[model samples]
Target: MICDQLNDGYDLVEPQAPAMLESLRAFGYNIQTAIADLIDNSISAGAKNVWLLFYWDGSESYVSIMDDGKGMTEEELVNAMRLGSRNPLDEREPNDLGRFGLGLKTASFSQCRRLTVCTKTVNQNSVTRRWDLDYVSQTREWRLLRSAALNSEDRLSCLDKVQSGTVVLWEGMDRLVGETKTDDSKTHKRFLEIIEDVENHLAMVFHRFLGRKNNLQIWINDRLVKPWDPFLTNEKATQWLPEENLYFREDKVVIQPYVLPHHSKVDQLTYEQAAGANGWNAQQGFYVYRNQRMLVAGDWLGLGLQRDEHCKLARIQVDLPNSMDSDWSIDVKKSRARPPAFLREDFKRIAKLTRGRATDIYRYRGKVIARKSSASYLFTWLKKVKHGKVFYVINPDHPLVKEALNIPIEYREVIKALLRLIEETVPVQQIWLDSAESLDKQSQPFEGEPSREMIEVMSQVYKALIKSGLSIIEARKRLTTMEPFQYFEELVNRLGE
Candidate 1:
């Protein structure tokens, strides 16, 4: 509290512990995020391995996170359990992931009613502290217990195995598991699912830490959590755009844009895995990180750009230091971030370039048409801008269209009028709505079904090319370069046959 000139005039007001703890639970932390907040503290303590244990006894279910980091002493554990323990404005160590110092308390309270932290340091006796919300509510005081809850000492046995470490145990998980039977299988499945959610969320949020060879290891019930890299960097098909660096008040912000491989380039399993937990479309946008920990994943950052299917491949990585927390409006939850005005301008430019490149790769089969061959990429519907308004027309020079035009001159006008009618009523608005609403539902040319229809269409195009004074080899080559057919290499090979 800042001192006033008339300090004696201020009231001796303090918040009620029960009400304050309840309010702290409303920090918008889900189980996964709250757990990640705790892991941030463990990482700050230089933990190489963090173990999470979930014990299921229905209503008595609890979650424990133990880290092999430098543990806190009795004094440190007491202060760490206090609400708003450290000032957010204080200078922290370079790799510290904490701000406001409320994570250890707030994150625990968000998931459970009883928050117990047992810690040990090298050559020092172990210390335990408990903050039972029920006790605090009944007592109506800031009573921080110096001992663990009765019979809960065994849960902190992992601390005994390590010379120095911290074990944060959460009991009375009212938010996660409410009053229920101890032997209910249905609820047990839900408990397992919650554990899975924690695993996946941790895998993504701390992917940078978990990705390295021997960096950080997070285990849930002895099952190791692997990093889920949004940018599939190992795949040769993924396009890594030029990295750009921006600075705000002399603080470095590195930006790297990645356009993931098209679905055709990779196998089905790899493609599905790369889609991420939210699928491909929802997982497309700027992934913001602070201190190598992901803060915001797959957001456009209010750059006025909608998540379009063509731009689904564009995912930009923006890394920032904790010093820019205020500049980015980083929340205590660490789940959201907004760019400063200066950085927003730069983000807009980069988004446009990345989105444009992604659109090209998405539409053009991820191949540079000019460099690939002499044949230009085909667009079934060509955009023409004659007047101020824009419109699309079918390319009449296409082989199929040309073949129809070579029908009798008498029926040529009929074909022309039919083409005009089809072009005029192209369902542009409907197509946009379908693509925007359900991108996966929208089918490409002969998408799911067998390629019998495709082969038949290719045969017609092949015959037309042959009729236009082209040899069998030339006609087959022409079909290979055509749209839709280019993707079917085997079908293109058997075009003339």
Candidate 2:
């Protein structure tokens, strides 16, 4: 072995180009959310105005997102398109939209296999870059192609309407096209729907910035995207936090917890707006943002509460400074964020309050109409029943009794005779026993000992049955049949007890 080592030199094999496409696919994981991340980049790049243009031509449909941000130079454009080119450890400038330089290439490639970027700076001539999957597969390499030098007329033509801006065109949209009917007509309709979806998502994701005067203006197919603020503002009132809590460590972060209005207090429009603003539908929890860029919209972080209607009503806004970005476990897409263990206690406290308030509003119908006092009907019934007054003393004046006692004069007279017998006796039990004995003598059936209340209510029920066309005995039987006689007997026992 020593002799062989003396003669042999180590042969080094080059490392394979580290599965570039596979790594990108993994890094660009969330297709639905990744689109939002790209739009965030466009916004963060200081793009005042952006447009999502859709072109449909059977299997050749494409999407172009053009923005008026500061366009990159030739070298910068090359680096921007390169995968994992930006150093994650390097501190970013305040307001920079990109962290890992992977956003442009990865996000674009995640949606479409081919991506072309065109940009023009103020003084320098315009540059174009294209990344085609077919070209990559053929060469087994990731190539950044520079356009032929722009001649005087070509530069004028290229710079014509683009005035210091960047245009990102995505073609070969295989993933988006999918298996849907690729017919021109169907594709156009589908493209419109996708544009609408993009518009809606961007509006919500950038709602804060969109609300500002100089905010980002996003347009899809000539139609401007309106930023939808989830925090509903209407004539009713704004839902505000019970208190604003600020936390500090090495970085400054603010946690504002809001208690939404009771469900009944908001109209459908306002409620829907609130729900949308707070990511209320099925996802509810903390909305964490870094440098005004949303990292996670609605998540409970394994808290017991799952996203549901109750949580949707809650809105907690967490603002984190750039220093704590790594501590929060923020992903490249800026779609996921996690608070540090130390910060979680504070977040959980705020989350608990927000969730509790939302649950209260959902269950108790909000603070506005919460039970200020007990139900009136139960109180009234208790008051009347406690007194020794004849049940009819309270009944005849009551709405339910009045409605039940529509009877003929003859039947009314008979009921009056029974009441007169009760009025004559000081002990009502003796009078009731005597009335039962008299009813038995007259061949009428008496079910049990009748309390004054039972007699009065029964009289009304009997008369109502008779007026509806039964005879005296038939009406009495029908009234008893209306509800269990034992139920009335139980009521009498309860009153005595």
Candidate 3:
């Protein structure tokens, strides 16, 4: 038996230049995100320490990142300079820093036209590769150039004397320099300012790693980067949720919920740390981090359910193990992350409870003053009934009180005097009787009879007390116990005579 043979033909297509690299300069991708991508590559290269050095001449400036990592061979260095060469699905060492290979090339090209990567292995001679935008534009090709034997000395002279490491230099920053300014002095000042801004960005992006004793140390110029933790440390303020452990196959995910301190407990430093770094802005819910890297910095799937006024004070930190990356759908930029459908429900449940607690605290604060004032008045009234030493209530001056009322505490004297007048001249009974007459609008009334209008007025006065902050049940009990209505009935009989 003869088997039928099938022939498959392949067609060739012309090579095209990548638009992403060119678009970087055109679109002004020199912001924080692009800079962060550059650092991420350095960290992934097994660098235990990285230094970002900026040199600003009157009108020209360059930025360099030097790291002490496992340097690559001449062949490896060439591949490293190529764009999109690293496969995301390729298995890497457990401690490898990068999965996507586009980070270094794209990140560097986004900032400058010239990207020079120089490396030296522990026992091997150093090698260098250069990717020049001008060269690419002229040749219409992405070419990686290695140093020749004669140029090796010259190339090695430009690099630092590190035993085993790599240095990434970004030069010919025409886009960054922009059009010539008025004078060299003005241009130099602007250059310095840009460097400082870049330093701030790096400090925040690598804050967790920089702060760790075992993790890498990153420095800008000569200044050591300090980590800024979003969670404020206040002894008075803490929200600890029960520790929750969820298992997915062999992976263990820990969900620890935290309630931030009350607004009053947070100082300026604490408030800024919480509000600025932690994304504590309204509706800015949970912050999720993977491998100590912030993936989803704020909110859960944009639910918008956490927009309560008190929730502005809430922040929950969710720690996800690296194994959960597939479950989280972490993006290449690391700017957005999402939990799997199954895990989202659990997160939403925790978020709801945390936000509810914050709202309760906010509501309690709103009523605190009224409740305290009423309690003081009740205490004073009780003292009078017992015929004990007359105790005066002293109002404490507090910010909460100031926010609630515009009047000064000195007005307390005038308010007390008015209360005394009502207590002596009107009496609870007479006031009720007068209110009854006004409500009925009757001229020819029975001379000595108790009227239904008087009873209604007394009921209304009790409601007013309840509305003033007392519980309705409590106000009713107080009104009956005081016998204010009974006293008003007696006054009506006397007035008729």
Candidate No. with top TM-score = 1
Compose the digit string of candidate 1's lDDT tens values, residues 171-283: 99998779978888888899999899999999999999999988999999999999999999877677776677888677999998888888878899989988888988998
What would the per-residue lDDT of candidate 3 be over residues 315-370, giving only the tens digit for each residue?
A: 67777776666677765566667767777666666677667666756764654443
Q: Candidate 2: where is the Cα deviation over 4 Å?
A: 1-19, 26-32, 148-159, 178-189, 233-236, 242-248, 277-281, 366-497
If scored against the real structure, what TM-score would every candidate get? 0.76, 0.66, 0.66
Return whichever of 2 and 3 wins on lDDT. Answer: 2
Model 1: residues with Cα > 4 Å off, grouped in runs: 1-7, 366-497
| Candidate numbers, best lDDT first, in rank order | 1, 2, 3
lDDT of all predictions: 0.86, 0.62, 0.61
Clashing pairs in 3: 429-488
Model 3 regions more than 4 Å off:
1-8, 18-20, 23-30, 147-161, 181-197, 233-236, 277-279, 304-308, 369-497
- Worst lDDT run of 10 residues, candidate 2, spans 376-385
Compared with the true structure, model 2 gives a TM-score of 0.66
